[model samples]
Target: MPDERTHARAQIRGVKETAEADLLAKKNVIGVDIADKVTDGKNTGQLSIVVFVEDKQPTSKLSAADRVPKEIDGVPTDVQQMTVELQGPSMQLVDDVTPQVDTTTYAVLHGGISMGPLRSVYLTPPDVTSAGYYIFAGTLGAMVRDRGNGATMALTNFHVACVNSTWSVGDRMVQPSLLDGGSSSNQFGSLTRATLSDDVDGSVVTVDTGRSTTPSVQDIGDVAGHTAATVGAAVRKRGRTTELTYGTVISTDFTVTINYGSDVGSRTLHHQIRVQTDTSRSARFSDHGDSGSVVMDNNRMVVGLLFAGSSDGQWTFANPIQSVLDELNVDLMVAPVVTRPIVSCLNTRLVVCNITRPVACLFTRSAGCNLTRTASCLVTRAVACNVTRATWCPVVTRTAVTCSVFTRAGCDIPIPDPGPIEGGQSEDGHGYGATADVPEEYWAGYLAALEEINELDGPDEA
Candidate 1:
C-alpha cells in the first residue's frame, strides 16, 4: 500500500534511513500501575492528573521512622492524598519538577512508596510533559461500538477517544485555545457513544447511543486515497498534542512492548515507518496540546493514532491503524474494503474469549477457538483456517468468557475449546472494565472519594 507522495523524505535522509529495524524485545521496567482515561469534552485540552494515593505523599518533610499512617481531625492521611496541578493558559510547557507539597499535618502519619518528582508525573500536559505511564503507550488503537450489535463500531486510538480513561461514546470532543486556564474554547469535536474496550485483563464492552451524525474520519491530511509503502515508508502524526511529529516507519510489522499494569506485554504491530522531523507540514512531532491527533500519509489518509512520545520526541508510535481495524471488525484501506473473513471456531479451530456466556450474550467473542478438536465441537463443516499467524482476540460487549470453539466458521454459538486458553480473565491486551459485573461495594468508596474530590475541586467545570 505504499503511496507515492509519502515516499521517504528526510532532513538527514542519508544517515538513519538505512538502519535496520531494532526491536526493544523486552519491556524496560520493574513494575508500575497505570490507569486508562478520564474525560469532559472541551477543546481547551485540559487533563486531570490521577495520582495514586501512594504518589501523593508529601516527600518534602519525612520523619526518619515510618509514622503510623492515619489522618487526624479533617486532614487526609498522606496515603489518601494526591496533588492536582494544571497547565497554565496558552498551553505553556511547565518544566519545573512538580512540587510534591506537604498536605499532611503533624497530626497525620505519612509516607509509603517514594516516587521521584521526575519520572512518574506529567509535570505538564502532553505539550510539555508526560508521566510515561499513559494508556495508549501500550494497547493498539481502540474501537467504540454499540452495546447491542457488534456491527456499528468506530475506531480511533484510545488516546483520541479517551482522556484519562473516561470515555463515553457519543460524547463530543474539542480543542480550544485558552485566554486563561480552565476555560472551554470554542473548538469542539462530537464523539458518538460506543462501547469501550475492557481494561488490561478484560474484553471490550459495547456502548450504544441513539445519536446520529458521527463524524466521518479525515486522515491527518486526508491520506486515505494515497498509496501505502511496504516497509520503509515515512509517516507523520498530526494530533491534539505535539501537533505534528515526524518519524520513519521502523518496521512494516514487528512486536511492540507494552506495559499494562502488572505484566510486560508484546503485541504484533505494524507501522508505515517514520522518524521525527523538525517540521511536519508545519506542526511539531507532538506538542502538549495534542492527544487524539491522527497520523496520516502524503495523500492524507490516516495510518496511525498519535498517542505517546518522549520529550525530545525521538520515538513515537501509533496503534497501527491496520491492526485495530481488523480486531474491531472494521474496514481499513477504503477502496478495496478488504476484510479478513471472520474465523469460525469449528472443528480444528482454537478460540479465546475474555469471559463466558451463553449464545445470547453480547460483545464476548469466542476467541483462540479451535473448532474440530476443541472440547466443545465435532464440527460438521470444514473451513480453511490459518494457525501460522498468532490471531488477535475478538472484541465483544460486556460478556466475560474464555475462548471456546463452535461447530463452524462464523458460527455465533459457543462450542467448547479444542485447546482452552489458561485463564478466563484476559486473552488479549485490550482491557475490559465490566462495571456491570463489578460489585458496587468495591468502588463505592472510590465513588464517595470522588464526591469529596468534586466538592474540593468545586465540581469539574465543563
Candidate 2:
C-alpha cells in the first residue's frame, strides 16, 4: 500500500515539475506543487498539481495567458488562492514601561520558544517613540547537533538568525529575543551556520557553555525523528506566537516565491511543504513570529521547518526536514531512553541454571575412623602351647557417606543496588541521582552516549 502511494505521488511530482515553471510565470500565480484535488471546497482524495495564486478571479476577468489550465501533462491541476511571504517578523519598538516576562525569558532553552538575532533600527517622526532601537523575534525551531564536530546547536530560519546579508558567524543570538524583552543577559548562543537556498532557509546556532537544552518541544513532546511530508497528513506545530496549532499537509514538492522584506528581497524556495489549518480547528496554523518552528506529523516525526506563511496565517510553508538537515549537515537532537538488561533462567530435573545467576551454596567434607578386633579361638586350642605367644589382633575400618539435595530455596536471587547520587535532587525535590539542570560542558559527552545507545538499541518503542 505504501509503495503504491509512493508511486502515485512520484507521478504527480513529475507532472508538477514539468508544469511548475510555466505556471509560476502566469499573472497572480505565486507557487506550484502537488496536492489533493479539492472540488467544491472538499478534498477529493485525488492527487493533482496545485498552483497557488495571489487572487482568485473569474475566467472572464483574467487574460487567456494568465488563466491556469484545468489539467497539465494528463495530471489534473488545482488553483488555490493565497499569498505567501517569509514568516519572520518586522522590527518594532519596546513601548511598554513595565517589563513582560514569559517563556522568552526562560533561562534554559528548548524548541517552540521565542528568539532572534539582536538588531537595532531607528524610527522617524511618524513612528514616535522614546525607545532608541527596534527589535524582531521568531521561534527557535529545534535542537540539533553538528555532524562534523558534534557541537550542540539550535535550528531556526536564516531570516530569523541572520536578518540580512551583514550577518556573520558568531553574531549574538538570544533567547526570548530582544523584541520579547530579552537583553544582553539573556544571550544564550551565537549563529554558527546558515543557508538561504533554493530548498532551505535554515540556520544553526551554537549553544553556549553553562546553558543546557532538552530535545522536547514545548507543549508538544519529544521529537522521535523526521519523515517526508505527505499530502493530507495531519500535522501540528508549536511556535513563539501561536504556542500550539494543528494543521494538515495540503501540498508537497512546492516551489514558492517569498518576500523577505526590503533587506533580503524575494527568494524562490523549491521542494517546500505547504500546510493549512485543520478544518476541525479554528486557529491559524502559524503567524509572523512562528517562523523557524518545526512542523511534526501526528506521530511526532518532524516533516518540515516552517519559514514562510500567508499574511493571515491560514496557510504556511516549510522546508522539508530532510533538506534542512542535509543543508545544515546536522541531525535532530532526540531524547535519550533509559534501559535495563533482561534476565531469564532455565530449570532442569534436580538443577537450576542461569548464565548470570550468582552461586548459592558452599560445600565441605568431614571424615572419622573406628577400630574393631576379632579372634580365632579354634586355632588357638590346637596350638595352645605355641599360641601362648599368639596375641590378640586389632583391626580398624573407616567409612564416609555423601548425599546431595536441591531445592528452590537453595538458589540465590540477586538484588540490584541503586548507584550513588551524583548531582543530588531533581527539580521536583526527588533524589533521582541526577540534576534537573546539567552543565553545558557535559552535553557533548551525554549526546555521544545517547547516539551510541540509539545506534545499538534504536529508540524506545514506547
Candidate 3:
C-alpha cells in the first residue's frame, strides 16, 4: 500500500501532468512542478503543484488570464519566484584576467573535483575580438563502470563535458579544468557517452588506463549505492566550487525550464529533484562550477546528479541518480563493505589474545577493560594484538589467576605481572578488577565487546 507521502506525491504528479503546459504558457512562469507548499516563506507540510516564476506579483497587478489558480484539480498551487539556470559556466569573454587556480591534484581520480573538456573554445564575442576566450569547467560527479565492458568512467554534466553541440565522442576530458589552470597534459579521459534530454543532462568519460579511480566522493567517503530521492530527506554534495554543502529535498518529479545559453538553448527538464539549501549547515546548496556534483543522502547513497540551480544559489535542481545511470548505461563503482569479526570473553579481567598465532593470552591491569563472558572484547593496550579471527574462551570464575610464573607447552613466552586487578567491586565485596590496555587498532572492537558484556552480564559479582 502506498504511504501518505507516496499517495500525495502521486496526486501532485497527476495534477502537474494535466496542468503543466497551461501553467508554463502563463506570463512570467518559467517552470512548474510538485513541491512542499510554502506559506509566508515557511513550509506547511503539504504537497502542492509549484509554479515557478521569474518574479512574484500581486493578483491585482496581473491580468485575469495570466493569474495562477489557488488550486488545480483539488491540489494546492504554490507560486514561487526564482530564476533557474544551468549550473555551469557558459561561453564568456575573458580578456586579461587570470583565472583562479585550484592547485589540489589527485593521483587517483574520483568524484567531487574540478574537471571539464580538455580545451574550452576561444570564441570572439560579437564586435570584441581582442584575444578573448571562454574557459569552462565543472565538478566530476562520480566514478562509474560501463555496463557493457566493465571499463571505468567519470560522470559529469553534458554541458560540463560536451561544452557544445559540436562535441564528438573521443574528445579529451581534463581534470581541474582549463578554467582552473589545467593544461592539455592533465587530460585524464575522453567523452564516451552523453545525453541532453527531459530526464537527464549527464555524460560519461572513459578513464584512461594506468589512471586509478575510487568510488569515494571527496570529503564524503564512499558511496554505498544509489537510491530514489525522498521529499524532505537531508542530502549533501561535494562540488568543485562549493566543496561540500548540505541541502534538503524539497520537491521531486519536478519540471523546470533552464537556459543552457546559445549552444543548447532553453530546454525543459522533467522529473527532476529540487533541493534547497539546508541553512543550518550552509547558506547555499550549489553554484556555478558545482554542476555535476552527485547529491547523496545521509547514508552516502547517491540520490541525484546536480545540474541546475537558481541564480541566487538558494534553490538547486538535479536529475535523479537512477535516471542518470540508466541514461549512461553504467553502474556506480563502489567499494565492497568490510565486516569485522567479534571477539568476546567472560572474565572481568580482559585478556588480549593473538588469534592468528598460537593461543597466547596476556593480561594487563588498566582501567576501562571490564568485559564479561559472551561479551565481545576490544581493548586498547600498548602492545599490538594479532587478532585475525574471533576466539571464544569458556566461562571462568572470578578467581585471581596470577601469571608471574606461568608457561604453556610448545609456547615459550615471558610472563609479566599484570599487578592486582582493582576497581570493579560489587555490593558483596567480591568482584574482579577490569583491565584495559589493548592496541589502538583493536580499541573499537574491545569497546563494543565491553558494551555487550555490560548489557548481558549486568553488574560485576563474585
- Which candidate wins on lDDT? 3
**Per-model TM against the reference:** 0.32, 0.68, 0.74
**lDDT for each candidate structure:** 0.31, 0.72, 0.76
On lDDT, who's better, 1 or 3? 3
Q: Candidate 2 at 238: error in angstroms?
A: 1.4
Consecutive 10-residue window with the lowest summed lDDT within model 3: 373-382
Q: Extract clashing residue pairs from model 2.
A: none
**Winner of 2 and 3 under TM-score:** 3
Model 2 accuracy (lDDT, Cα): 0.72
Ranking by TM-score: 3, 2, 1
Please, what are the lDDT tens digits per residue for candidate 1 over residues 1-462? 234312322211222222112112211211111111123322222111111222333444544333323322222211212221111011222332221211111111011100010111132333335433321111112233433454433334443334323445445322122211112231123444322232111112222244222222322322243233334456665432333345565433222223221121222222322334445444445543333344565555555544444334444444455444444444432333457756454534322222222122123345664443222111111111222212343333433334342345656655433332222222333212222333435435533543454455342211
**Each model's Cα RMSD:** 31.8, 21.4, 11.9
> Which segments of model 3 are wrong by more than 4 Å?
1-5, 40-44, 60-64, 90-97, 122-132, 342-462
After superposition of all CA atoms, the RMSD between model 2 and the true structure is 21.4
Model 1, clash count?
A: 104
lDDT-better candidate, 2 vs 3: 3
The sequence of per-residue lDDT tens digits that candidate 2 reaches over residues 404-435 is 22223434433233332122222344222222
